[model samples]
Target: MGKKQRRMEVFDARARYYPSAKLTLEELSYWIAFSRVMGIGPVRFQLLLDHFQEDVASAWHAPSYELTRIGLDQRTVDSFISQRANIDPAHELKRLDRLRIQVITWKDACYPPLLRKIDYAPPVLYACGQLTEDDLHYSIGIVGTRKMSSYGRQVTEHFTKELVKGKITIVSGLALGVDTVAHNTALDNGGRTIAVLACGLDTIYPPSNYHLAKHIVDSGQGVLLSSFPLGIKPEAGNFPARNHIISGLSLGILVTEAPPKSGALITANSALVQGREVYAVPSSIFSNSGAGVNKLIRDGAHPVTEVSDILEHLNIHTVPLPDTSVLREPENEEERLVLALLSREPRHIDDLIRDTELAPNIVTSTLTILELDGLVKQVGSMQYVRCT
Candidate 1:
């Protein structure tokens, strides 16, 4: 028998055994196969599912005429036919099993409920770590420029720590800069996080974050998520599609810092379209990095200066804190000097050196000591600021 005939036969045999909401192994394989198709995205895939009576396996093996009738153009139908002819659903599942990547269909109970409410919610997600009930309860999508300023870093870390303390699950695109800081700060605070990737779960895009990805998976504190199947590379076009999932999965989106027309802006727009709240941290008007954020604030995004702003907007009560709001007295002359030089605004090491007339080594060591004592935080590039 032909491969299409074989697929139909298998579908027929399992037709009586199909569950109401969950995908069978064979069904999941077809879902994975559908994810690999270029022209068939969330909306087209949904059309196929509905046309096939929600049997994705049957839809996967649907003939060209049926696909064209379901609104796929000739070119797209041709591509889908050619791609389907080459992929093996069973072998794809085996590859996923080998990589330890887990697949969840839209019908799965564990799928993000908020994501399901979106118009083009991903039909399937490939994840590298555990996704639990709590992750869905309260999630904040944090996004910003890959070229983050020290001030952006400081703000991201501060708010991320506070969110974790409030038991909010942090979500981000797993890009560089703000995304990395958000994930690390959440993990550091012993809270859960979820990283939605622009590529497949098998490949960590940006490569530098491979160790961080592994830590998230192995530590069970976060999940690495993607809508693409295995072996998909992080192409430029993939990220705009990826941004939808980030916003779709979150309760709201926080744009820490972005330049005009940045990818983070795309995510914020997506959040607004999805009816999720968009929050922006107001930044110095002089900084280019803050331009997008300031515009967002002007556009009526909730302006957040502190974590309480976010918590208040979300109506989540903060956990009680110990009484340690006051800054500690400096232990020595060097510590006193470092404290005197630092302020709420982030200052780079070179600036400290220029102002203090102290050796760079002394400045660096003092900043490190101050950071360890929770009196200071290193934002990036040897920049330091007082921890509020």
Candidate 2:
């Protein structure tokens, strides 16, 4: 079948399984806006839908106590109904459409089936990029601690680049530490990455990653997504709500480094609950950052010592994906530093940080780009061996 046909088939299947909306832009805008209401998680919201029976707008319009019966806490039901009138409050859909971001509802064919299967799937996703046929098949989630170690940072960067080289959609939360490294590494390597946010796409949470978030939207090749709407600041609770979507969209999640009780651990937990495989980069028992991963491994999560570990676990033959490291030409001083230290020989990242005088993430990122271009090969956990 043609790619479009295949994508449509996927969506059509979802439409069959999910509650139908008006399917109008206005209806979609309503769901998009309502998703922003604080305290309305996917499960509670789905319970309300059961009471209303596929009529989100009608259910949204129902009395506050009506939702309380369906599981929305009294306070949230009040807030949600109060917020319903503005569901498309800012004409954001027009702006989104103008910018080429596609909006996919739970009923849409393009929504990830794994994500849709989650108990509290967003009523509609305000997507900033297209989910093509190939996307349906080759999606992976790479996430972990925001304060990642140099080792965690490098493995996350390397494996994501390898996946991107294979034309996979890299999914992440766009948080500062590892998510930023993962998204940025994917981009630098000429690979597209999706950033799932805890807040609305209209605003960036960390603010530092704003430019990176913009880069994804501007590429028209990937998405910046959220269940929340415009004007909402990110809150702590909204974050785990955000984690589900990240794990929901992928075949599995890779925990590069996560301390006990870390948010990345929350994502890993979500992956487990969602029936997706979870992988961890085993860290030294001495480091606090590695504690969660060690615990996860002890609890039976697979350990990812190499890229092949993930690829093999997913059963994807990684040999065919295009090499983008060549197509991704580096610019200016940063590029110069990276190119200078990178050689065909296998080099540990510590030696590169010393030799190139670059931050570990930067050197790791640069090597990722070169590797994606088919220019470097990572031979060991710490080594970057240039491909040519």
Candidate 3:
């Protein structure tokens, strides 16, 4: 039999198994099947959708000739044909359900709004945990070198804590070093975070962070997301592509610390290409670990020193400070010194001490008094911000 005839025969045989009664599920199954096909990415899948009038089931059943005519190369058409013949779309959906993986397609209402605006956004996302509207809207990608230095660790933790205070959901690759620190800090601070994996949801890459991934899902703090179909391994080549999704899902990308050759830079580049803001921490010239972010700053990425820099650049309005006039006036010189040094921007106790030229004992006591008086609020750790 001819290729078209064979395709028809396969379709006919599976007609009864198709979830035709549930049009949405049926269409989604076809989309999942296409996602499993090699060589068919977001751009090609979109072409099929357009040619088939947004009917993914029709696209899946389209003859080899029709697929080729619609711009799929012969190689891709052959891959699709071979894959579709063996892939029972309904069975694929069942597998996802069994694994508790939620699939978000382009047509789904819960699809990330920021991600949808990117060029060649993934046609489907496999999520292993809940994705809230807050996660989709208030996320920032915090990525850096896997072999992070002490400075990198400190910077990542500091920024993560401050951003979490602003109610920003952190997004990271879930790699070691900076990515790990970003996720942990966000979680520790009781903020939601999302981990974008290069592999399928079935296997968490770097196996060591499995517990971390579990914590993210189990705590209901965030989600573990991927574009790759189940059974896909985390190959070296998958990461660069994965970086695109990281940037795509975020309102902006932040490079806390990265070497010149770090993959974090790739994500930053993707952010710039996607028209998303790219922020980098200023790094020392002597430090190799800081080269990538320093270059990023030189290339016009926003050099961020504080959380407000990011929030302001994104035009995100944080919670308005309470009016200080209602609060009791400062009772001592130490109280006035500390209050004068604090603002809506968070300031660490050490910085407050150094800036105010006060004793550590005095600064700590003044901050305690201010907290009690509602004149200053401790955002997290020892960081304090003015009530007004």
TM-score of 3: 0.77
Instruction: List model 1 lDDT by residue over 1-388, tens digit each.
Output: 1111000001111111123266678878888888898888888887887888888888888888988888889999899899998899999988877666778778788788989899888888877776777688788999999988888887888888888877888999878899999999999999889999877776777777777777777787988889988777788888988999999999899999999978999999999999999999999899999899999999999999888788788776544322336877889888888788888887888988898888889988888888888999876667678874
The C-alpha lDDT values of all candidates are: 0.82, 0.72, 0.83
Model 1: CA > 4 A from native: 1-21, 69-72, 318-341, 347-368, 380-383
The per-prediction tally of clashing pairs is: 0, 9, 0
What local lDDT score does residue 72 receive in model 1, on the 0 to 100 scale? 87
Q: Is candidate 2 or 3 superior in TM-score?
A: 3
Candidate 2 at 75: error in angstroms? 6.6
Candidate 3 per-residue C-alpha lDDT over 16-47 given as tens digits, one digit per residue, 9 for 90 to 100: 22222334777788888888988888888888
Question: What residue pairs are clashing in model 2?
Answer: 11-109, 42-120, 146-177, 324-373, 325-372, 325-373, 326-373, 375-387, 376-387
> For each candidate, what TM-score against the reference?
0.86, 0.71, 0.77
Given candidate 1, what's the lDDT at residue 305? 85
Give one digit per residue, the lDDT tens place, for model 2 in 80-171.
76666555534765655444545677667777777887776777676555565655667788888888766677678778878787788889
Residue 222 error for model 1, in Å?
A: 0.6
* Top candidate by TM-score: 1
1 or 2, greater by TM-score: 1
Clashing pairs in 3: none
